[model samples]
Target: MDFDDTPDEAAWRAEVRSFLEQHRGEHADARAWQATLYDAGYVGVAWPVPAGGRGGTPMQQAIVDQEMARLGLPALINLIGIGMCGPTVIVHGSDDQKQRYLKRLLRAEDLWCQLFSEPEAGSDLAGLRTRAVRDADGGWRVSGQKVWTTLAHLADYGILLTRTDPDVPKHRGLTMFVVDMMAPGVTVRPLRQMNGAAHFNEVFFDDVLIPDAERLGEVGEGWRVALTTLMSERLSLGGGGTAIGPKPETVARHVAEHIGALPADRQVLARQQLGRGYVAALGARYTGYRQLSKLSRGELPGPEASAGKLSGTRSARDLADLAVRVLGDDARVAASRDGDSTWQNAQAGLPGIAIAGGSDQVLRNIIGERVLGLPAEPRADKDVPFKESVA
Candidate 1:
């Protein structure tokens, strides 16, 4: 596919750049900036017009993302809402659900978190044990714990996955819902990481009541709806060049600046590692373009999302390691004395990227089975009921 923007795409890029230039300083607050983007129709370029989006092509969306990143603009604070939840809702939600959630979501009026992972069910997400039981009032009462939920403490709403029927196979017994984060019986506690940040949280639902109208898709179809969210998530996380953290170019610059100070014997090896990291990053970026090509053609992202994420996170982690290597002993001293923990934090935090969207082993299995059309792996529990399988 041609990398150059077509005439229309070039014009759209110009329009986006102009808007950013004019309002760059006007909205310092992240939510205000996102609301500005919503009013300007830049929030959901790939979404349908009827769904409160711009009705534009995915290329337009990419252009907007590119421009915003280039300018170092404040990121849209409701990334989980706009990037994952809104798209999932558009695909699986009822008209009333769309009308109630889309506009507020786009305008950053309500932040959203995803409640999919549990202590025992992260990589084996289909094995989650969160339960939602039918209530006497045509609603449901949920009880479970979700761990590693990003931004759950601050979110106003969440897209939750729960087991509705344990008698069925694990994947078949699932259900999805739109849940209020602050509702009674719901609690969120942050998980402190090694980097001294609590960006992730553990959330609990103690028989939280959810009205029937808040259900996302039909009961027992939550796995399908969740696939939509997961696909979008992998795409976002794998989109290279600063999606995970510092850009490859930025890392390379740091290496170049500090490598000369190293002993001549060490300089050669550092330069070689820098080149390797930069090339891997470029590969990830092109992989992102491949996913964008699918989106441009109106097709949903496929297993290639896993490939991109797997490679991108690995590249980011490698580059971070290279940066610290070039800095040598100063990496630790600067971090402790000067509070310059940029590279140190990145080094500590990027390993979780491999685990967050999906584990490296899980992603490889997806690519092997789906992309390569390899023979499937044996699954002893494939046909067993969830409850029986657990027993």
Candidate 2:
């Protein structure tokens, strides 16, 4: 894969850098900065210009993201919209759906959340029990509960996966919909975490009405659409050049500062760990580059994303542990818990990385099945009808 930026890409990078310079230290309103970026054709740079993007390449998009992260700029408010739902809509949505969602999503004027994971269907997402019964008037009544939904309380809409025809096999019965968060019978309650942040929510949908136009794909085609969403999610979550905490370079510096204070044996152990973590971080970064390379060449992501995530999250957790060990318990005070504050937030947040996108175990299954060409896991539920299955 080509690694160096083309002349056009270099020009785009310079333009993005200039825009960033103009907005430095003015990130108080993240949405405003995002709006500015979108207006300047920086947001969704890889998307088609006709589809409210600049039609840039994936490698250029990666470069833009890298520059933004390097500048410590606040992220756009439409994280799920841009990263997951927008890509799905672009691929599988009807023209009207695309027209309604894509531009607003890019500007952060409309936020969205994924309503896929239920209490019982977190990892086994296809086994979800949420039902959307069709009415004679071409709308559907949604009834179910979804847990671990990030930003549901703040979302304007959600991409919901529901069982529309339970008589069929579980996977075949599913359908996806775009539900208005303000619709009647939709409820969202915050779920407080160990970090005391209500980052996710428990949502209850009691006969929420979704018009026929809201359905994302054909009846029984939800699984395919949902796969699109999940694929985008895997790439966004794993290949986004996400750093869980301080860069390993920063950590190495911090560790070096304490090396003189530690005993000889501990110093050796610390140095060894630092070296290993640095190597692992490098591996994860290169893994992301590989994914970008594939995307640049118009190839879809594969199981290697799991490898990136497995290594990246593991490295982040290890670094967080090292930070806590070095900083001691006093750093846990909430008021002092900045990004660099003892890595308390990182320690609390690292577990979600392993669980979110897909669990470490689920990722291993993908790697085993796809990368290694191993035998597929036994699936008793494969042909089971939805109503009769024990899911």
Off by over 4 Å in 2: 1-3, 240-244, 258-265, 296-301, 329-342
Off by over 4 Å in 1: 240-243, 294-303
Residue 154 displacement (Å), model 1: 0.9
List the candidates' TM-scores in order: 0.95, 0.93
**lDDT tens digits, residue span 65-121, model 1:** 889999888678999998899999999999999999999999999999999999999
lDDT of 2 by residue, 58-113 (tens): 77777788888788776678889898889888888889999988999999888899
Cα-based lDDT at residue 153, candidate 1: 90
Residue 270 displacement (Å), model 2? 2.9
Q: Evaluate residue 122 in candidate 1 and report its C-alpha lDDT on the 0 to 100 scale.
A: 94
State which candidate has the highest TM-score: 1
For model 1 the local lDDT of residue 349 reads 87
